[model samples]
Target: MFVLIWATFLLCVCAETGLSQKPRVKIPTLTEGQQATLTCVAPGLCSGSAPEITWTWRGAGGTESYITGSSTSFRTKTLTAFTQRHISTLTFNSSAEHHNTNVTCKIRFTGEKITEGGSTLKVNYVKEVNITGGTNVKEGETLNLTCSVESFPPSLIMWSKLGSDITLHNDTGSATLSIINATTGHSGQYVCTAKHMNNTLQENINITVIYIRTPQIIGNTIIKEGDVLNLTCSVESFPPSLIMWSKLGSDIILHNDTGSATLYIINGTTGHSGQYVCTAKHMNNTLQENINITVMYIRTPQITGNTIIKEGDVLNLTCSVESFPPAVIMWRDLSSKTNSKDTGAYTDLQNDSGSATLVIQNVTAEDSGQYTCTATHPDTTVTSSVSVIVSWFSKIQDVSECVLQAEVLTCVCISEGFPLPTIKWPLLGNHKEYAIKTTVSNHTVNSTVSLKVKNHGNSTVECVSNNEKGEAKKNLMIRSVSDTVADSSVLNVGYLEIIIAFLIGVVLSAVVCCLIKKCSRKKTKNSGNLDETLEMVTSQDDPQVFMFIWLFFFFLHNYKVFNCAQISSLLKYTYLVFWFSI
Candidate 1:
């Protein structure tokens, strides 16, 4: 140390002492606002006079001045009589401005040669640690941060993010942390550390990245009837975003919260099916997501048609059901006659979105049966049934008659009609004593009526039959009492034969009389010829005359005709003899 210092001092001397000069000393490092001291000594081997030693100060700008008076004091120590050792010391308060300034010690020898040794002043101090630049950073932009401290010898500065091991910046006096294309993950608290020798200081700054992530909506878009519907919305941001749920075109808020929101629909139906929206609200920014929900349901089936119809009328039926996402419709005839198209009956089926129509044309008895309608959907099926009947007008048949037996006159009238026509007998006007019987076969109806009429002669009995459609009547003539009693001959031949017999008798009588008169008009020869002609006409000898006589007798002997067809010979002979006498 002595040789190094002695060489430094020798370099500063303007003239050679030939002997070793005093050694140079290291400048003291002074902290700001603290007391400091400095010392300089003259060479102990110097000859003569105890050389004068003084201290001067030069600023960093190169301006020089004497360090004077009360800040500087001199002390001397006696060594030997011939050569004496001399020293000087300077004292003052130190600050950061005094750092890097020059201070020098000067000595003037009695030989008129001057030499000096000087050192640069160093002061150690540090102000408080601080961070600069914006605390908030936009996403995808450059993130710049600087940390610094004012201290002599330049304090060590460090930048680091809190809760992390990695250091962002490390330097002297000032440190900057820079990240390009920053993201939301870069938001956190940052720290700046200023380290001075034996003294440490730290500063903290909270950095937040202003950014928003894409919003997400989670749920089922379609829902069944009478089932719960759930939906959720969420987003990530610096300050957690606000999430809200709402239906499109409606202002009512279904759900609202921070960070996330959930929407629920209990027992969802067709009325609740529509578009739903999930929105996330951030600082000066709004994000949204949307979804659609559908509710599936079905209603009961409805049928429309008349149960009873005319025989030839049309039978129309309609089946309808309401549901979401339309359903399929079908028609079926439950009767045995599935092929209704025959027999002038046909079923026409028409289908639409939610309904079905069945048209039965030219309805007949075969068309009268049970019919069913069905509506089918993905979830369920609906059905309805109806009954059909065909009706027709009533009519009477022609085989109606009356009969008589014993003393009691009984009448029977037969008629056939649809819906069982009723038969009524108006014998006199009204008779409650009569009885009526009816029988039915298929669509035909037979009615029989019976009554006793003891004095029913030369009168007419009336029979009337009626039904919903129409009515019919007939009359029967009553015969005489004698004819009803002992009229065997008339009854045997019937009235038709009796009429023919009478007509023949009249014509024959005329011819026979005319011939007899013609013979009588022949005069003389007359008397004898007339007698002969009479005999011939009456005798059955001449065919024309005989036929006339026979027919005449037959007309008067109607009862005889029933008794015997043969004529008695004795009676005929007597008749002839009597005729001859006339």
Candidate 2:
């Protein structure tokens, strides 16, 4: 019975806990500079039941404060004056300063003093904070950094970084720190400190400095004799550093040195060709560096003359010189003395001393002159002049042949020679000697001899050409006209026609003279016998003369007429023969 009673008590306690239990309230999140609201609903309580509500806030330190409560009943909480009534009948509006603060909402029975379950409210804030500008800086460069936090008034701003010094600026809400011409030693972390009454915030930034070196060079790398050499050294620095130069013997002080390190090398020489050191001194420390240099030599050479000649021509010349370290021959004009005519083929023949000979080929008058051969070497130059004398023989060109004719004579002249050969005609028959004309072309020269020839005999025409080398002559034979035309019948026919025409002309002339003389005699006879007219006497001499004249004229006329008739007959026969032949 006692066990049953204990079980009944446990059952009664479980039932009471289950009937009074309420759902756990969910907490709403908030941001900085915004409002937060807390609310609780009693699912077990009916609408007609009057439930009481109370709201309070708890800070980070666990401190609690009464925010609101019902006027009639302390369990019923009233909304704040700034709360919106539309979204919820119970609400509260709070600022960013209350960020992370928790608001608790408790619901209770109207007549019961005990509270039910509650909910929590969380608030968030957006703080505008950033570090502006470059965190890494090179030595000898300006360094600047800024920390900005746009906040409400009465907010304090301070600058600092982790493992760094605290930087403070007054009067401005934003803090900025700047280092002009900074160095590697100025690198560290930076932090910004901002505070208000009973409130404080902080941010951090990192900064690093890079170191660099700059140096300057002076004068020409290549120098001539008696030239003044000047070199200057410089570098970029901060905090002002001392400049000095170390040379062969000792170190020297440099002038005009400010942020830059300047060093000068005066009257440099081969001895100065070694290493040059530049040192920069800042406070008690010094940085040094050295550079190597090599000096170059100076000089230019001159060349003179023509480098060409003809075959079989002797080349006589010399090359003169004037220079230091002696110039070496590099190139030649002719290349080689033999086989120089081959295209693109060249020769390189250098003396043990490095001088070279330039030979060219097939030289005409163009090959005559002096030539210049130059020798080249590093740092110094020398030149030489060669006097080249060329000798060559003239060559023959353009051989031609022609034939001439006069009457029964024929002649052939062979004009084959060079150097413009002279021509002469032999006295033949009754021809007179006259001037000779010469015609010349690129490869050939012609000589024409003007003279007369009357006989059909063997004759020769000659042309001779001469130079420093030797002379050459050309000859041709002449033949008679009859011999030349003996095999042709056309010439014989033409000659016969000429002969017949001549005979006819002579007969006509005789007839005309006879008629004139007869008329004149008749006139004279009439004048002497004017008294009577009758019988006329026939003189025997006149009749005989007339008869002889008539006979002579008839024969001459017949001869001419017969010749013409023969020619016409021959033409008719030739037409018939040609037709038959065809």
Candidate 3:
């Protein structure tokens, strides 16, 4: 009983002492490079309890430790959670990264419970780090780096770039260091440090940022129509770049020599003259560049000339022009002389550069005029001229023998001369009835004249041919028809004989008819009067005797009929006869 009472008295004293002193919780022991936590617990403290807790540092190098919340001189920094919490906690991952660190916990109790503790960390695991991905990155690209190490219960991970701290995404076993939308400024070596349970590991990755995808010039930038043209297409890439030539906006191959991003053009033409671009591909990135090409060709040709020409002279014409495939030569005469009205002769020659020539044969005075030579090619036409001169006109020769009336007349003269000749009658004044006629041949252009005159005494007539140079005349004779009729006569002696015969016949017939009629009448009357008829006969006896005498004379001379000139002689003869007969 005496020993129990003595223990009770000792316990009471100890309790009082505990209440007077600040309570401190024991900080756990931690290994180097390992994650750990130091807790300061005041046992039996309620939510209303207020305590002042402080953390102190004790270095592993045997230096003096740092303290806070006490009047003691120390090199220590008080953490934020320790200033107000009655139970203080230092939550951290223990690693080799902190192998030389020392930690201490102190508390000032506002209530009855208080605790104080201190600890030192010692790292143990072998430190290692691994950078799983490449260190190099492109500008404006995603940057991801994984840092991992063999650790227990995971590790505390950190990322840094060029000496700057960077946020890290950490999982249970690995940590990833990343930069979203990184640029050229973000290019450098990156370090990933991981702290595991009492172990520390680090990984350093070298990054060489490069511009692998670059602009390129693809295919031939300059091309021609007929021949090959060289084009240069250059690009920058990690490997060789892919360059191609295409028409505007199309994917079809524009050139054949597709090289490994270099200058190449197999066969080029105007069709290949368009936009060409190059595609530079590296990894998953691509770039492009463009170029343009144009084609050229030759133009057409031209010609010129004159229009007037002469007969006996040289004719010269020309045709000249320009073209792509070299111009062709042609000479055509668009005139009646050449016979070709439209298209002309084509003269093909090796020397087709400038102009072609056309010549005419020996010319005449009739040919003295303009001659046109037309030169025509594929797309154009031109004209030229030739001049000629001649000496004189053509020739003509011939005449016909002609007959004219019995009058002054002229013969036609047909002949040829240089400038043509005129004709006239030379004997015009000698015969008034003579006239002349002149005619010209339509086809021969020769002049001929015929002359005529009166048939008086002229024996011949003359025709003259004259011109500016000289004159020649020819003669023709004429006969007269009126001179033969001037000395002709006729006589009439048969008319007297026919008249005497007719008068005798008429007188005999009349006497016979009268005697017959008178005898018939007397016979009828004397039948009754014979005596009266005897007396009438005796009285007529004297008339009968006279008739007898006249009859005898008419018979002796035979009855004659005479004209008026014989009538007087006949009467005188009648009276002499009467006397003679008596």
Candidate 4:
């Protein structure tokens, strides 16, 4: 019983000493390439004597070793100023291999008392940077990128574009880069960087953007007649795009090339006017543009209506042409000089049917000429011609007159008419016996006739004028001179016989005068003697008067026997002689 009690008292005292002294260990977290500290401390409350501190560490691979003052990475210290304490310090350059390592601290007291404490050591370091995600992406889609780093203490990570100084993300952990609705400008290389104390790591990735654009048609689609039809097609894209031009609803390709193409028609016509399409093709993408083409053309002008027109008649003409855009029709007088009349001039009457009419009223001979019809278009012009004809006549003038001299007679007949009228003088008898002359001026004709007379008699002369239209006649009277000359000769002979009887009476009177003179001489003697003498003188005078009368009668008979030409001369001489003697 005594041995059991003594052993129990010693065990109680030892338990009290153990409770007063304990070992402490401190292990601090550190980055790679930085200094690390692990501390082991012996309790100051020790009974009767001070304790000694020791340290040991367990490696990541489950290996264990003691740390002492002589070790290169461990150090120890003892403090006795306030109270007795023992410390063991650990020093080293940290690395990722030191993570999750176990450190132990032991305390040795007097009488062979030992106590130990353990701690876990945490270390921080950066190993490498890795990028995760696809680099190739379509435009307008979301992009996700992850930047991962293998390290201890979780290194700071950041993302940035390669060609610029802009930072996409910056944080103390793994970085994620997200881009919403990316475009072509968002393409190129990107960098992810992992940073730790005195250490940096980087990784790069290339991103590509894909897209397509619609096609376009360039140049004017409206083409003139006989002009070249030109068109071009273009598109914008990467890797170039296929371009083609074709008419709508037709498989035939008008033009085919890359990027841009041109279609040309040598001489465009109305048939070539329609809807055309421009197509641009890329990888699994197609774009099209539609264009409508119009062609303009004109046909030659045609002239119609009356070409031959008579004088004083109405004239009508029409000009027509066919065209797509409608042509301008006009009438022109080719013979402007002949169409100088204001009433029968060319006039324009335009209509919507591509035709024009030219009307002329009361056309005269001056209006006979050629006329032209012209059709004009924007690109070309055409012309046609027509001719007009006219016919007319002139008036007629004086017919016939006559004159006679001595035994010759002359007759002249004149007629003036249009279209050269035929004139005849029937009184001229033979053609050789008469002279004829004709003259013409403008549309008028003049004819003259002359005739000679061989016989003297009362007769009639006539002239006749005829033409294609009608005929006319004129008559004149002519007198004979032979009977008038014979009547004048008889009156002249009777006057000569009266002159002879007067001459005989004149001779008797002269004899009586001589007898009277003798009687007057005797009258002085006596009245009786005068009377007897006058009676004797009268008886004597009777014989003398008888003898004188016989002589006068004989002379007169002799004169009557003379020829008519001679008697006319003798009578004139005898009458002059008798008057002079009286």
Candidate 5:
């Protein structure tokens, strides 16, 4: 009974001692490459002896071993007379390999009492940020990317595209960025940012989205005729799209290029006005766009009328033109040389759809001028003219007479008409040797004929004037040479006197022309003879000679303007009178 009580008392005391002396471990926050200290404290209930403390480690692979490369210190102290404590501190460099590892603190007392405490090790550590995914993706396909880093206590990661303010994804573990139906607009550089403890890290990746845009046509749909038709077709795409321009109904391609194409229709006409299509082909897709073009134009005016109308007849003319827009028509007399529409007092003007008509009642000689019809449209103006001629005949003047001078018969006849009447002498048709001349002014015409006659003629002495409208005739009365001597048609000089004056004038004219030719040749030091008769000098070396030549040509060119049929006749009328007066 005494041994049993002694054993029971010892067991109770040991239980209390064991409960009070359990080893305690204190672990603070740890980081890689930082000096770390782990402390194990024991109760100080036992006052007789100190406790032996040691450290041990268990790795992530479940391997266990005694801790190495660490310094440990043991210290004992008494808080009071009845209380005592022991402390064992272990110091080592913190590393990433220590993360999630198990460390234990063991204490062995003098009475063979063993006690231990432990905690799982934790270290704050993070590596460089990383992004994983393919950077090149097709349009309308999914874009999958992951941003992550190896870290203790898992770092916060975020995914963002460069130049964007919004974060695409964020996570405490791997950050995943998922985009459905990606487009070319989504192409750019992406960044992955990792924040771990006191460190922030970033990594970059480039992505490209390939796609094709809708084809578009650029140009004016409405153009004027004869203007160049310019148009362009283009598309936005990767793997450059092929662009082609073609007319709507034709299979021929007008232009072909990559990404863009230009079509040209030079001097485009009404035939070129139609619909055009722009086609774009990329990868496996085909796109098209169409545009309608119209070419506006107008044609020249056409005039129809009777240009030659008889006197007292009605004149009618019509002007018409073909154009897209109806035209404004006007009838005008071009004689005024003005743009304002002006018609004669006796004229009627009427305008209809695309045409104008002009009518004149009782057309007369004054109406024998150019009459024009003008057609004007907003785009252009066209004009057409017609020459109108009024025909009429008047009788020959009764003053017509025949004179016999030195056995030569001379006759004079005059006629007046519109479309100037033509005079014919049946008497001259029988005589081959005759000099004839005709003069016309306004609506009057004068014809004269001279022939030698020794005796009475077998044919009648008649003058006839006629035209497409009517005819006029007169029989000239023959008179003795002495009786018609005062007639103004011939000079009233004696035959011998007339002959002498003509010879003298011819000699004088010849001498003057020869002297001028000789003088011009001498001035130029030319050896040519005076063979160049009365012709003007063409040499530009002498101003005086040029002036003289100019005047001579002027006179020679103007002499025919008057009724001076022959040089002899002029001298005969004037020189004779001068000689007799002198």
Candidate 6:
């Protein structure tokens, strides 16, 4: 009997504990501030009378409490079947504090028997979205971004760039976004999203890259004189790098700006040529580029040697100019009709520093004129000139002839020379009055000298013509005063003979008149009365014959003093008196 009773007790325990399914509790995870429902199902719980069912709660800290009717709701349902099933539900508003909390359902029978079923409350909620990472990163480096959600239900987190629909990272409660070899293109606003149940939260952060690349310099390296020089410096960076331009060896900064800078040099010269550098500064690092600039220039030529050279002497000249890219030197004679280089009389020697020497052998008067030295460069030509002069002389001419008229004596002399010769009469005496006349035509001089010969008759006169080169002279003799006196005596004797002949003729005419008058009176006395004829002959002959003879002698002696017309008039008067007496 004892063995049968023990077996019966074991079968009853197996039927109550193992043979039936345990009461089930089902609860859903919910976001904060949302309504939640807990369901409890007990099958085969109907006995002879109705059983009591109650609900209770347990906190995550192991505390327990019976649920009241004010903030909680309980509902029960029975199914009509041979084996009855009973269902109970507990409802409440969920919160972060309700996470991991437990809700229990209990049933008590009439004999003081009890059964219970419980479920843990999982509240899917997040209090805030938290992000922790660096926003600034260098180029070509690694970028790390992490996002965490501080919530009870372990919210889903996702990382995405702003204005993009694709997700970069996705995980539960936390997520990390990593980028390898980050560049400037990776810089922008990023969005981190936390999602739980029906709630979604987002946070934004900006990312930037700070890095500098090699700087670029833009301009022509080779430049001409007087041209404007322009150059630009450029760089690529995230933080907007500082750009600066400067010479390679100098500390002076040419330009400075933000991202790009420009350097301008107006009217550049040879002094502006050098090495230039462009530097970019970013994030405590610097990058640079070097450029070489060359300037081409030239200056006016200068002549430094003697210009005046003597005949049959050597001529030397030096020409120089200051220039870059050394100039070509040449010597030219502007007065020469032909090219100077082709003439063998000139020699040219040139150097690399734009200097040259010109040599001429045995210079003559034909080489006198303007000579030029020319320095030529690729951009310009310069020249300088010098004038040369030569001095010389010519020969003098000889004296020609001498002439004499009355008391005046004249002599002529001539000379031919360059720069004109001077002619003079050197032997003119103080007592003798003289005049000298000189003239020049076609570089030839002619001189005439006249002197009054008074008592000094046999004097010698000299004509001298001279110049800086040489001198010449001639002498002439004058006739004596005795020879001139002898000629005058012959002329006086001829005049005396003419006067004696005239006087004799006058005396004979008077004698003829007296005879004719005496004969006429004798004839008249024979023909008529002698007293009337004698009276007529007396009135005609006596005083008229004597007056006519006296007048003829006066005119004949003074014939040399009076003219031919006066002598002829006196002779006619004497003839008229003689005819009247007859």
Please provide, for model 1 over 1-582, each residue's C-alpha lDDT reduced to its tens digit, 9 standing for 90 to 100.
996676556444413552246436445768788878888876554334556677888976788885433286666676544334567778888877678888888877666656688888888877888788888888889889988898866888888889887887899989999988888788888889888988989999888888888888888877779999988888877688999899999999988999988888799989889998888899888998888888888888888778777777888888888887677878777663545545645343556668888887888766767777777888688877788766565544444544554544545566655445777766635555454445567556665554555655635567777778678787754444443464342122235444544454455556556666654322234653544332332333357766756775665457544222222322333345445444
lDDT of each: 0.69, 0.49, 0.50, 0.67, 0.77, 0.69
- Candidates in order, TM-scores: namely 0.55, 0.29, 0.30, 0.47, 0.44, 0.51
Using TM-score as the measure, which candidate wins?
1
Give the runs in model 4 whose Cα sits over 4 Å from its true position: 1-163, 174-194, 200-209, 223-227, 267-270, 282-285, 304-318, 322-325, 336-368, 388-582
For model 3, the run of ten residues with the poorest summed lDDT: 485-494
lDDT of 5 by residue, 248-284 (tens): 9899988999999999989989888888999999888
> Which residue runs of candidate 5 sit more than 4 Å off their true CA positions?
1-155, 163-168, 174-186, 194-231, 264-275, 282-306, 312-363, 369-415, 422-439, 446-465, 472-582
**All candidates: CA RMSD (Å):** 22.0, 25.3, 29.4, 25.2, 14.4, 19.6
Worst ten-residue run, lDDT, model 1? 562-571
TM-score of 6: 0.51
Off by over 4 Å in 3: 1-310, 322-329, 335-354, 365-444, 452-582
Clashes of each: 0, 26, 41, 0, 1, 0
Select the stronger candidate by lDDT from 1 and 5.
5
Lowest-scoring 10 consecutive residues by lDDT in candidate 6?
485-494
**Model 2 weakest 10-residue run by lDDT:** 81-90
Better of 3 and 5 by TM-score: 5
**Model 3, 1-582: lDDT tens per residue?**
996676566545544554655545454656544456666554332222355666666655666554322232222233332222245566666565455466666655454455565555554544467678766767678887887775544677777765766554555467776677876666677777787765667777877555554564544444445656566666554344455555568877654332244445555555656666655555576666676765433333344443344335555556565433344555543333545435653332122444676555664444444444344444555545554333333332434323443332224445433334565555555544322333455223333222343433545545555645456665543323343432111001124433444443344445444444454223225464545342212233235645854564465355433333233333344444444433
What clash pairs does model 1 have?
none
- 1-582 per-residue lDDT for model 6 (tens digits): 996676566545533642245567878766668787777766453423455667888876677885433153344444433224566677777787777777887766456667788877777667788888999998889999999998866788999999999999999989999999998889999999999777899999999977777888888877899898898888977678888889988889889999999999999988889899988888789888898888888778888766765556777778888787788888877665454645535433334358888777887656666777777888677777787653234444434455555565666676665446787676674644455555568667766665656555556666676767566666655433343443332121235445554554556566776556565443344654455444334445356666766776576547644334334434554455445544
Q: Which ten residues in a row have the lowest lDDT in candidate 5?
A: 339-348
